[model samples]
Target: MMSRRQIALAAFISPLLLSTSASFGADIYPSRPIKIIVPIAAGGANDATARALALDLQKKLGVPVIIDNRPGGNFVIGTGAAASAPPDGYTLGWALSAALSLNPLLYDSLPYKPNDVEYIAAISKSYQVIAVPGNAKANTLKEWIAEVKKSDGPAAIGVSSFGGTVHLMAEDLGDRAGFRVEPVVFRGEAPASVDLAAGQLPAMSGILANLLEYHRVGRVKILAISSESRLPLIPDVPTFIELGYPISAVYWNGVFAPKGTPKSIVARLSEAIREIVETPEFRARLAAIPDVNYINGSSDVMKALVKADQDYYGRIITKRKISLKN
Candidate 1:
């Protein structure tokens, strides 16, 4: 029903409008608030990291940032929520080593697959540690292993969660150290740490950041840490490499978005986080914690790192024949 002149104008403007729409969509990503999903309960390391990142991101990106804790199903609950979110710039997820690298290999089924999410940037890397009660008779890793040998049964080694990074680290370190450790799974690190500190549990293994406070308070004794080099925060503590075990394995935390999100959006998000991580304030905060390893890069680099890490963990799981039953 349009006249000739009106029809001509509409057709010309439609192409220009389409081009502008695409440009605006990509350029002004995250125009509103962004949500970051943490697949662990609040108060845990993962949750804390997410909150810290959210604070900085909100300030730099000039938009409100919100954190949603979805802790359950061994991290599957919150992770699944992230995987299923719309592939826009709005919903971001925290990818832990457990949910991203270990889950697909350790479990028979999962609510989401590795392909469901895309990596944005690396937040922090941490190594695991083996600790015992402060009052334990054995003071060193060697003495502890010798004492376990003299015992009738294997002493339980508490891991924060089943099939988590620490669970695998404990088992793997035990193998390398020529000892038998029966892993005891806990719902989270705080409870296991508390019980270990109170002497209810004999031994516990977890990321150094989680146990360093307990060590500082004399609630627990950190005998050995699993890292290639000694952490600067605890120069007195020896690493697995230093103890002749060469059992250094680390856990990484990164940011993620649902798959199929625009590369422009992902790149913007990655740059924002990378800037935050490089700031002196960020490094200072990490230094306050124990043995935090910082890794930063572009979105493409992070993606490549994820693929390589996935394969590495997958190989380890296969070689160890690690199953959920263990």
Candidate 2:
């Protein structure tokens, strides 16, 4: 026969204890600092975007956000670390299109599977562009094709990374436009541009950021962009679609947590990111990067996005027999 007061107290405390169980997810998420893992070396687009997002998230969450660069093994080490991290929201990482969609098809063994992570939000996107040196005789994509048909040696195209989406785009371009390209991988876009500027590399197709400076300085000339419509920034740069060759693919940057991250916490983070991306300041700041679009999506949408890219890129890689065998 318990007293009424004791019964009421027991009922009240039971739920409180259940809700605050330390073994479960965070009671008030971001109670501590958060670490975001970037899969690439610092100074590139992914790293820049990660730092920007960290700054925005810190302002919104009121907690210190740190970027951890884990660049190695073709993004496997960093991304795998994120996937195996505790399901708490503290550990998140860059969900690159290359890693999510192409790695599984490219590599023999990955530490974590695609389902091992939950995508939080898509932060940015970039479009591919095809370009050549300013002094090159080929003024248009048609003229460039004509030159390729007459070329003698391997038709080399510099790519930021080997076996990435850029590599596939180059391959797909060659397949669709009827030319052969030997993808020459450099440490990154900067070094590749050095070769292109010096005329060591003939033509390159990659995310626009890599070639923007080169194009501006007349070191490299952009012939076409892979967008359905002409971009306001470069109205003169025609799209490949209108030229009778269409490559409709957009490379996006995404945020992902280890699978099983609490839905409530994920929702909060996603909402914060979605709001930040909508800000005008964010847009103006990212404009320097080129062809970047912000995407807001639910976990299901993110999952579907990953699946669609996997399927789209998978077909190209399979037909071309592109594999890392790592």
Q: Each model's number of backbone clashes?
A: 0, 0
The numbered model that scores best in lDDT is 2
CA deviation > 4 Å runs, candidate 2: 1-19, 23-25
lDDT per residue as tens, model 1, 1-326: 99999999999999999999989877877689999889887886667677878989999999999999888887888888998899988998888878877787788888788778878898888888999999999888889988887888866899988677777777776666666668898878888988999999999988888789889888899999987877668877898878888676778888999998888888888888999999998777666655666787666666665676667566657766776631
**Residue 227 miss distance in model 2 (angstroms):** 1.4
Q: How close is candidate 2 to the true structure, as a TM-score?
A: 0.91
Displacement of residue 113 (Cα, Å) in model 1 is: 2.7
**Pairs of colliding residues, candidate 1:** none
lDDT of 2 by residue, 1-326 (tens): 99999999999999888877864546568789999998888987778888888988899999999999998888898999989999889999888988888888898889988888887988887888888888899989889888887878556888987789888888877888777779988887888877888888888878877777778888888898877888876777888888887677778888999989988888889899888888887776676565566666566777877888887788778877778977
Predict model 2's lDDT versus the native.
Answer: 0.83
Error of 2 at 296 (Å): 2.8
